[model samples]
Target chain A: MSRSARSFAVAGAVLLAFTGLASADAVKLGRPALPEEIKAWDIDVRPDGLGLPEGQGSVSQGEELFQNNCAACHGEFGEGVGRWPVLAGGQGTLTSERPEKTIGSFWPDTSTVFDYVHRAMPFGAAQTLQPDEVYAIVAYLLYLNDVVPDDYVLTKENFPTVALPNRPNFYDDDRETTEKAFWKATPCMKDCKPKVEITSHAAVLDVTPDAGKEGDKPAGAVE
Target chain B: MNQMKPGSRVDRRRFLTLAGLAGACAAVGVQPAAAEATPDPDIVNLPPWTQALGAGVNNHPYGVPSPFEKDVVRREVTWLTASSESSVSFTPLYALDGIITPNGLCFVRHHGGEAEIDPTRHRFMIHGLVDKPLVFTMEDIKRMPGRTNRVYFLECAANSGMEWRGAQLNGCQYTHGMIHNVVYTGVPLRAFLEAAGVKPKGKWVLAEGADASAMTRSIPLEKAMDDCLVAWAMNGEALRPEQGYPLRLVVPGWEGNMWIKWLRRIEVGDQPWGQREETSKYTDLLADGRSRRFTFIMDAKSVVTSPSPQAPLHARGPNVISGVAWSGRGTVTRVDVTLDGGKNWTTARIEGPALPRSMTRFYLDVDWNGEELLLQSRAMDDTGYVQPTKAELRAVRGVNSIYHNNGIQTWLVRSNGEAENVEVS
Candidate 1:
């Protein structure tokens, strides 16, 4: 055979060997995740009513249930007990002397109130409440926020209708501004705050060592 | 390294080989002889990882803390301490070692469960009390100049808070367990605060997370400019999904609560927002009716990890006891180990490089008498502040508090080479 013909034969043999190896190594053991499986795991409801399950709850039912199950910890009217999260009223306080994170004033999504309750709530026993009970709680939360009347019903059909006050306040953060303005700024490598000006090293502020505590034992003691 | 005798080496080899086989047998469901006997009362044995394979793959790209570590998690005994879903978990710092807390071992405290945030869609917004209100995408953060430092020990204020009065939990994992040390990489918070051009009136800055809880906290602007780091990496890799993944707040020496995870927003403000986390949950209660708030920095502390409850002494002869010592305030100057309780304290030899806000390993060379003895450690920070005794701690702050208890810990060593949690009053 001619040299060219021999080379072609060698290449063909190599290809056949690799193809056989590939087929031999193929192990189709685990099945690919189906869309339904993916959907089930990814079922997270956003505050804006994204991904809410199909169901409905009335504010009155929510009010009665919230009083019994949630009031002890969350307080009556969702004001929040002790240091628990505030569920109602921080309206227009974003600019106030002291702002609070309340369900009505700070939360950017109504769907979040529903999602959190449905998945994990009541401290120890999470996800025990029925779907309607979750809806009633969400409705009660809405009533506390004054977003809807006490009689308004919260369900999958009308869940997306309710809006949050802080929705506009929560604009997507743009770190680019930081990059251009600060990260790219030439570091003060030369005159970097000469001496680290001690504005306040108060005992409460003394984040460093207390004093004389470092290397207290004789230096050569370890050896 | 100090060399020992042939007899000891043989014992060690046999012990390690047997230990390995026992571990293997346990993995395959052959319970060891010791396992059947009520697991050592003092020693907590972690369950095998392969046992709980419920609802398999892609169930959690990253798994939750081990069921063994469940009790070591952060919990809110009361609600209203945070809004309905917002909460926190304590790190079992006392049960970990070598400075890297396994991802499965790290504690989690959250205003909400792990925020299902997609880095592709996530954005960070800076507004309020700033000359300009701007927004940045996750890509923008990557483009920014960042630095990495291997700092150690970021603790929650509530670490060991339970032990303020008397020892509530029997082990160090419960008492002084709410801290973790790791290398962090991030753009300095100062870089961002300076970029925002804080209005002169701006005094405090609030950071918010993107989870269902939408957690937020206000930090003093001065502190932000001083040494705060806006971290994106932990232990040289991207933050774990549970640990804020793409980005988190790093306030060295301060409580972990302020280090918001899955950070999305920072709003400069004139004063603290007095959020529920700060007022209701983190604050320490005093007998005087007034609560102690803003008790931020963790005090100096040290503990003997080897002869500790979980890790008991194996051989009785000359034992090289080792442990980790750290201070949120600064470098550990010295760690004194007391083998005979508080009666005599010999200065422990710090072995590794002692960096500020980092874990410093210390070792004590002492012969084991095969007798019951009390082992304790006291840490002295660079500032000459010695870790207080349990009594001193209870004296300064009444027992009603549930945070920042940095008292000296005692471990009772029995003749059999086992250790137990103890109190030295």
Candidate 2:
């Protein structure tokens, strides 16, 4: 018999055996999650300040925390160091050739800053920061971005009030309407263009890694 | 008939001369007039492997690729990121064939690096708006009903981000290697969600990783129930450590960032948790200063793998152009090939099975007369989406949108049998 036919036969046998027991609903295998377990892992914060913990932190405290924990990669003033993410100061360069998408300039929500810092910040050592420390770091980041005064004390009450400048510019994906012209059912198949000219060459840039020399040791070989 | 020893110096000299002549004849498609005078040494002489016994059945408990394929590997451009821990490596696409990318050779993208987790101690928790917040051990999940297997392609949104402005990467492996197709064995995410009993108000689900980054993304509950898989094995083996060994979320037909590796938690909520990846990084910024958010699906795209910069054409006459085409929305129904720029096009044969949301291999055989040619491929998916040119993509998205660059790639092949990545007008 063919492979499909054999698979069909096996499936029929299994179906016949499980006809009475099989149900579409849950089998209920795992145990109920305890309240403490739920609290420990459910750390995501929404834009409406839903998951923010009750805490207060000042810019001065944030400045110290930022320097100690984040300055190595994000820089002292959040300027970024060596391809690391710049957290501040790219206010109006989005339309330019090089748009520096910093948290202050391009980010859409402040909860994202607090949630990310609390959940995954400080790079190698994550989830080690206390709630107050995350709040302080977020405050310092706001100060660096000129969104708050140096003496501003950020609290869960005022977290929702601090909005990002770029929030209004973000919209849902509009590719279907915006790029409808390019979705030709029968695209040009003959003489689409009169002549073709070479505009750019990757050889001229010469940025590709030398695979021949690194064949023995693969690139990005983790330690 | 001086009875020369097989391993003697005279025998070696005679073997080399005859091998060189045989190679020359094969290159020009000619047969040696006096076949007996110069017997092919490769066939006449026995190599060491033929004379000696090979290793036993269990020589290597886990087999690896042959040493001759050492060049086939994942590669990274060091300058692209701050550290290797939070970086990406490209799959060697030029050296690969068929739809299924080998598990060892699949490209890896990590946020806080690979995590080595003891499966016995690992736990997956589902909480928030579920009727019964539940936590399951590895064994508990394995015992769940409705286990399934599926094939899908995971592609990074920033696969061709570097070429948004112009051709920057010389090889397809660097330019378009941030993708891999594999069969995943797991239980449908809906099965777990149903067991937990999702609350009526739960509109979205936040999937979080257990890695140091704890990478998180908010996925629509509709999509979660549609085809998502809480996958544990890939290509019929326990997942690689770099690929989230214990468990990972499989968000089919979506950007790879949503497929959280080292998956440990899922929190159902009414609203999207605007995390750092969704707000600041993955969002596409247009030339008009506005940005497009939640752009998840990767459009149809294809690339000529062989005859690329790394795998250059080595001989003249009949040559087979091989490539891969895929779509996040649906199956790649057709792929078209263009030789002399876009002046003319021909339909390439779609080889192998054309599964939905899976890579489709394509080939086009042609006779080359030693002339310069600009090669390109266009993919059309079941969703009626056609791969756009770079110029067309730029006119709408602009160069600032660093992600979702599914523009058609062009490779210029010269008369000398070498190829280079190039953009044409």
Candidate 3:
């Protein structure tokens, strides 16, 4: 037999061996998941109103809920308190030096707001809010962002209609194209520049936590 | 030349030699019996530890580092966030020597807090866009076939984020410590996905955690079936509580947030979920105000760990410069070290195994004459992607995009054998 034909025969044998091994190792282990179990855990919502529950809430009701449940951190008007996230406003500051990325200014989809609030909001207490309460809080947040009227009632039917100002600004990652020029195979080695100088010093900032002072209450300590 | 008996007397020649040495010391105006005249007490006298017995085996049912190593620990920068429960603690990279970070010293980043989970009661569900939705208990997962082990570095996309504008953190531990390399032991996610039989329409998978935050991220189905793992153990033992405990999704090479510790559910879907993390939080805001979404893969990056601010040079004669380099795309092929900023560069020797998407350690040995030095490292991966300088990165992505800052790092070593984090232009 020819050398090329012999090589092909060896490759075919390896493929056959792999196929046999795969079949022998296929010992399918898990049991079928109940529909109720899936419903309880699969709470993700897509941008096209895929997983919203049947519910409706008014901005006035959301005002009361936001004050009682979220005002301490998110603020009464979603301007934010302390270092907590600001949930509203910041309409056209995306181009600024320090952009305030609130729900209205930066979020691309209303489903994200509803999904995040339902899944992880209320800080320490999460996944406790009912669907109507989430709708109500979202309605009030929209009013705060000036995306809707104060009397507006958010419903499952109109949820997809509520568009965010920053929705059109988001695009898929393009670093491979936009930043391709920076990827150099043969970067300069020696004498790349005439001179080098210290432009900035971390010590001048003095923000680094003191290594000696790292005790029981270290920085970023959990409660 | 011969073994001595317990009660044997000293020979005349031995006694004479000792006496002569003592006489020489006395003639030199030094008291041979005085403590100060002993020259080196450590050699003359035995340490207490040599005379005492150590603790018995299993003294601690599980082992811990010695008390002398208490200073080597995970540290947190408290003011970085509003609450401690939803914060991060950095790994002590300056004190570590090799590629593997000890499980105890692995950095921890929690959205809500570390969840104390009972493994027996935990359940992982795979549903949505599958032929058969399945639920697997911890036992069921362990008994599955096709178990594999892989070593990879899990890095938060925001690692070195503070250094984007300039040199903000003082040490490599804070600036480059938000990453930990480990060997994960688990079955391939494909094993389970194949059992469930994904429908053709399934294009993405949403991984959800069991923590109070129920932290979630929508991952592409192509990635889910490619290299993802339903990992249960890291290093050799079960996962640490801070690291997800019973279970976690190992999204190799992607951002650490997408790993989803304490993972309880994966919902396959036809399109991306557009979750809050992907939409508002993790997305990179470019200089033009337009944001880049799904910027998952962490680019090639490196940093000099020794001769950094925290681990300063102690002596001036001979020094070994060591650091770690890694890439999300592939194995690091080359690492170049520069002692005079970017003006001169020399290839560093890479030590030990260099695995794909894993941390590779490199070292450069140099003789020092107490001159000021500016040190930097640049890494190149198998994909031909070279780590960029801070200036080069900023020229394209801007400093505002606080995530995926894999720019080359610089450490300035002074004549006094001290180092400081500085930006050299």
Candidate 4:
């Protein structure tokens, strides 16, 4: 599509014309999505191995990468630094008062570990790692969380074989069925309760901030 | 421009009056007769601007809020997060009126940080199970057919998370500022997905961001087809930088975090991805140790803004108690206000026609006898979902997790006319 022609086609794509089709018959507005562009992004990995890229990495390589890049915030053992996320152990702790929901402990899929590390790992500097580096990191995370042995070398071929122990623990949202009693067309209006008493006060929590003029503090700034 | 200089000390009452006058002028088409016949001694006297002509138009290629209204802005709850980049800023809810939160003053909440994106270099790619894989440039997205303008609220799942255990935030902004309502103008997600032609196996869609967090979430195909939008503009203008600038996903009525900012990619698949965000972060941990995943819909909720901790009653006698009520399931059918807490209640008048999955302005007037009162509001939606109390909410889902705390809020007003955040049982 030519530049001006593309603009004209897009002009038709404007907001008002969108009582759009109910199905995918295609309307030829934007150009066909290219394979190279999809390949550059298309980085998501699903539990069924549908989106995993062709790559292979060893746990040994991942250990070196993990120690150099991840240990600072995630802890040397993926136990997590001050408030950063913990990536390793916490097996069998889901029911505990403070469950450690690390990648291995509570995550239901290994593909999630790969997808997350590849796209958003190394904290501030994301999407800067190579495919093999991400795969290696995933391997090392598995070794840390006891999902795989130290000798395990992950590849796209064997990706679906590994699964987290807590995979079956999840269930789809059932709010409609579970919370039916909460619905009331005509709610209780007055004197519904015998008496009401103060249970808590925010002033006692001592967490609210003092409001000041703008430029007294930065915009879009939180304390 | 007869603008007050920045940092100049002007009485708040005086500013409010001036702003109200300016607003009235703008609304009523500047009738000279409406000006006060005689300037009151208390009001600021007309300055040099009345004597000399102000700067001509186009002084600002892009305009900004009036200098006199500078104080109306998003504020930060300093102790909420570790750093400013990955933190939140609350809207000046008390200062705002009606349902639409101004574009500049809308609350901001980011995960990793704002991705300073360059539009020319940015594009949205849709792949996976599709007939024709496609990528859209900023212009391409704008040109796409089936553009829609829908109004909805984007609420952080943790909007009232601080109050899960007990009342902790002093202001309505802090407790509920994590939500904002806007009319999003964009192409429907279904249009884009259908343009690419979905394969029969595609059951879920993963929307990904371009920020440092590269925030991603698995949205069900049913929702992707229902009302989701691939939005570029908000409230009729280009999106603000803090609001994902050039392009962002608008998952109406869902938790705000799923409205991925700086949206980059959408991949269709057969099953839920269970990414770190869904599994590790956004999931709710229940009392029985089982966790509830994909709790997307924000339940019906309401809050009294005028008598909040930050917005205290100024004088005794007749005062209109006003606030906003909204629901994710459908339109807000009713909002009941209680002056003496749960003991007595009155149905507040809905200001206008209520819309589904959007904010509704509500008002209730009461005569002040100067007695102590507990101000509370209860909202019910078309789905018959009545807003739950804090005690009712806590009983079902323990305070183990912070997200999805949509409980009815309470404000205690003393005879002195000051209000404080409090919980009543």
Maximum-TM-score candidate: 2
- Per-model TM-score, in order, reads 0.58, 0.91, 0.89, 0.85
The iRMS of the candidates, in order, is: 19.4, 4.0, 3.5, 4.5
lDDT of 4 by residue, A26-137 (tens): 5666677777777777777777877787798999999999999999888888997755667888887776655677777778889888888888877788888888898898
1 versus 2: better lDDT goes to: 2
Query: Residue by residue across A99-164, what tens digits does model 1's lDDT show?
Result: 445767766567667766765576545667777889998898888888899788888878878887
Candidate 2 docking DockQ:
0.46
| Among all candidates shown, the one with the greatest DockQ | 2
Is candidate 2 or 4 superior in DockQ? 2
Ranking by DockQ: 2, 4, 3, 1
Candidate 2 segments exceeding 4 Å error: A1-20, A211-223, B1-37
Q: Candidate 1 docking: what grade?
A: incorrect
Segments of candidate 3 deviating more than 4 angstroms: A1-25, A211-223, B1-38
DockQ for candidate 1, please give it.
0.03
lDDT of 1 by residue, B128-178 (tens): 677655566677666555455757677777666545534334445544555
- lDDT of candidate 3 at residue B412, scale 0 to 100: 91
Candidate 2 vs candidate 3: the lDDT winner is 2
lDDT of 4 at B365: 60
**3 or 4: which has the higher TM-score?**
3
Give DockQ for candidates 1 onward, in order. Answer: 0.03, 0.46, 0.39, 0.40
Candidate 3 lDDT over residue span B282-358, tens digit each: 88988889999999999999999998998988764446789999999999998998888888787888899999999
lDDT of 2 at B18: 44
In model 4, residue pairs whose N, Cα or C atoms come closer than 3 Å (at least 3 residues apart or on different chains), thus clashing, are A10-B143, A13-B143, A13-B144, A13-B145, A18-B146, A33-B134, A223-B78
